[model samples]
Target: MKTERAKEILVQLLRIPSPSGREDRIALYIMDFLHRLDYDVHIESDGEIIDLVVNPEAELFYEVHMDTIEPRAEPFVRGNIVYGTGASDIKGGIAAILLMLEQLRKENKDLNVGIVFVSDEEKGGRGSALFMERYRPKMAIVLEPTDLEVHIAHAGNIEAYFEVDGKEAHGACPESGINAIEQTFEMLQKLKELEPFKVKGKYFDPHIGIQELICENPFYLIPGLCKGRLEARLLPEQEVEDVLDLIDPILDEYTIRHEYTEIWDGYELSEDEEIVQIAKKAMEATGLNEFGGMRSWTDAINFMYNGTKTIVFGPGNLDISHTKNERIDVRDVVKASEFLMYVNEIYGKS
Candidate 1:
């Protein structure tokens, strides 16, 4: 695969808006590209799964997502970096995957490998979860922006919604009704006391924040309802039940009601695994030495939970992901493509 062609593919993928849950357009584009290569690609009925099979007997596979965070602007490259919404978050990884596939095709050697591109990773790992439920691969390499390092661990997240119900009364009679908005603020203050929940050895304690608060009513009357959304980032060793227990003491009052939603468990890989070993070898071969930590939720957790030894590896800096300034270094993409190709070769031998 030529460097210019790789860049062109990256730009095209970035131009397509594939926000979480809406990846049909980009999925179609990917299918078309793969079909033109005469590869055996199978897409699920709902179009969320794009499976490219290089060798049916192969137990090794690579995974990437088609969806990205909402876009802020069109993609454009200035010098060695490409700027856009999903550029760094993962279109770069996708581009590298495409190029690697092309290289493998040209070699025409027997390779027991495949690539699975799924949807809904940005929201929840529904696509990955579904794939794992149906297909059983011995090991997988999940592509996410990791600046070309091998990410052996990732954190999970838990989101909860809080509601406070209050009675409404005429403004003329001030004390007759409870101001739910004020009560909500008080509740927030209590929750804030658990700030920076980090301990020395144990997985960093969850970081909590109030994501949303809504309470609107006529000034002449006290609001009857107040709603708040709370979210926490939990380390791999942490569990949602543990987080819920920690916050239970603060909700003792009868005024506040809460429920947990969007719980993602975390995972970590032992360094001695074959996947990690091959990745480290690949990094050494590629002259790269920056290992990274994926401190947020990723589909890798789904793969690991389902019994597949999985590692997250890709290009770009994750700090810019989901931000308007999201971008990736073109050189990094090229280097990642080379590294991944080497991993594939090493994997085939193993």
Candidate 2:
């Protein structure tokens, strides 16, 4: 695929607004693009997952998300970087994948490969989860912004809501009422006193933090209810239930209600795994390096949990994702596409 063609696809993808659940238009665009290549393609999960089957029996596949956190503005290029929402987060990777597919078509190369473009990755990875319910590939390459590195492992995460119940009373009669906000603080304090959860292969230990909070009450009345969203990053050896059990004592101290919104266990691939070795070789061949572990969760967890040896790789930096200034170097996109081509060639032979 030509560099200009990759940039053109990137621009088109960036212009579309696909935030989490709303990925129809972009999914349609991808379906159309793959369809034009005369590949057997279909939409699943109510158009949230686009499955392009170049070879149905292929054990090796690639996955990339079409969804972004939110659309910030129309994409534009400045010098070597393309700046806009989703540009660095994933559109650049998506573009690279499409360009690689085009190259395969142009050269009439028949290889065992499948492409999965899923929505809802940013929200809860529902699209990938839905795909994994039926199809299981032996290996997969999850395209996320990793600055052109071979990402072997990453921490998993769980999203949950913590609710505290307290008695409400007039502010003037302070002793008659219990404040839920105060109860929340007390719970956090107790939680902070425990040792942080750790695992050997993970990049970091288990971490728990509050993402959002809400307490409603009139000025004259004390709050009776408080709710906050909590996120916990987990390692492969760390179970969500185990972490909850650790915190259960503190929660039991108060009248707390906990609801888990999303949960994904972490995963790690051995350095000697055949897929990892192939990716490392591909990176070296493409003039890139095998970087360190990814510190955050991604859709890769979904694939790994489903019995696929999955690795995270792509262009740009994860830090630049989900920001107004999200961007990727055009050169990085081209390099990733070339690297992926090598991986396909080498892995296909094995």
Candidate 3:
């Protein structure tokens, strides 16, 4: 595949607004591109459901996600870099896959490889689960931005939402009701002291975050509820449910007069197996072992949980994934695309 052409497509994908469940246009573009290449392609009607590409009776497969974390922040470029919302998060990775397929198509030989670019990875793995239930491949190469290194592992994440409830009463008579807002604040204070819930972490570069409380309509009446969201980075040995267990008792107290909900489970990939071996070989062949950790949650854990030897490897600093100034070096894009071509050639059959 031509590096220049690949960059163009990468920019185009980055320009599309594919946050979570809204990946219609981008998915359509992928299906169209694959179809034009004379490959069998199916764009699932639900948009964020699933996509399938078959090698006209061939084998092998490559898997990726077409959705992103946000809409494009508008496109811009400076020397050696392209700046946009999806540029690094995985657009560069997707570009690499597209280019790899193009290169294989030129060889005058049947690659017998398939491709699937799913949706909803930013929120969950419904798209991937759809494919996993209906099909299985010789190997699955999940494309996430990992610079040029072969990321043999990725931890999971638990996006948790905790709420506090109270009785609403006239503010004029303050003692008439309990205050859920104040209770939520009290719980937040306790959460800070919960022993840190430590674990033997992996693929953990120690990433963390917190945001302001959700907005609610204000009135003279006491507020009936208060809620906040917290994200925990899942480690190989730690289950996403562990976080829920840690907070369950604290949550149960509120349950007597409130509500409790668990957003989702965190996922993890612990072994260096089939996908890992193939990735390592390709990296070794390319002399690109200088790889680093995923440092956050990704759909890698979903694939791993489904019993597939999945790895997260591609090109881009995940640190820069969703920032307003998000960008990826053009050189990195080309290098990752070239590196993936080698990975596909090496693992496409085995």
Candidate 4:
């Protein structure tokens, strides 16, 4: 593949802003690059998914997220580091794959492989799922920056909405209107008291963290409704339905009309599987000295849940995915591209 130019493509992707639910522009840009290479390309309107099939005969499908959290004030770099929102999270990995696709074409090396650039991976996995159902690959690799290691397992996330209600009245009659904010505080406390939300596995966090809560009309006009978004990162073995059931009582006790929606779930690749062995062999061939599972959640879990063996391996440091100072190492880009070539070849031969 064209790994030598990995840095250039990766840098270009980092400059784009493709937040969740707003990935059309970036997806089209990648589509252009893939099309120039003469590869089969298509965009799934469901999530604006941009998919590539460089070698139609290829069996393995490589996937990466094409959306960034946001853009920085100004592009800046210093000493092998570039700071921006999407650098490490995934744009870095996307660039590497794009360059590799081009390189494969330039070198006349057809590994019969395909690539998928998915949208909204930062939020719900609906984008990836849309592509997966339509184009189910035999084996899959999620492009999540993991410091060059072969990480297999990932936690899943379930996002639910809670709508709290209250009596609305004139601002003058403060006592007449029941303050919904007060009820929110009470509900939150009980939700926390449910306590000890356990997740199986060694490094998984047992308790789910509250992501954010949106409260409206807290002042001036009477406040009638308040909504809070709760996020729970579940374990691989944890049943999402069970967690939703656990929250049932808490919902009932509260004097409000609540709405719960299951956002998504997580998954893992059994250590003894064929996919795991293939990834280990590829990493060894690429001179990568490390391998493991990532603590953070990734689309890898989604594939595993679908009964497809999956692995998470890509360029950049995942720690920087959502940070203001996010950046990826240039060397990782080239290395990951080269490795992707080898992995694709292995999968194609198998």
What is candidate 4's CA lDDT for residue 90? 83
Worst 10 residues of 1 by lDDT: 195-204
lDDT tens digits by residue: candidate 3, 1-350: 36567668887887778888788789778878777777777655454375655552323456777888766478777766888888888888888877767777777544545667888878767888777666655456677777776666565555556666788888776589877777776665665556434434545632223344552538887766766665555554455556667766766776333333324444444445666666677777777876445656666555656666666777788878888888888777777766777766775466
- Cα-based RMSD of the predictions, in order? 3.2, 2.9, 3.9, 4.0
By summed lDDT, the worst window of 10 consecutive residues in model 2 runs over: 46-55
Number of the top candidate by lDDT?
2
Ranking by lDDT: 2, 1, 4, 3
By TM-score, the best candidate is: 2
Model 1 backbone overlap count = 0
Error of 4 at 229 (Å): 0.9
Runs of candidate 1 with Cα error greater than 4 angstroms are 1-3, 46-56, 107-110, 165-189, 192-196, 200-205, 217-225, 252-255
Candidate 2 structure, TM-score to reference: 0.87
Q: Cα deviation of 343 in candidate 4 (Å)?
A: 1.1
User: Worst ten-residue run, lDDT, model 3?
Assistant: 255-264
Question: How many backbone clashes does every candidate have?
Answer: 0, 0, 2, 2
Q: Please report, as a residue range, the 10-residue window in candidate 4 with the lowest summed lDDT.
A: 50-59
lDDT of each candidate versus the true structure:
0.78, 0.80, 0.67, 0.71
Report the Cα lDDT for residue 138, model 3.
Answer: 45
Q: TM-score each candidate.
A: 0.86, 0.87, 0.81, 0.80
Instruction: Give per-residue lDDT, candidate 4, residue 108.
Output: 91
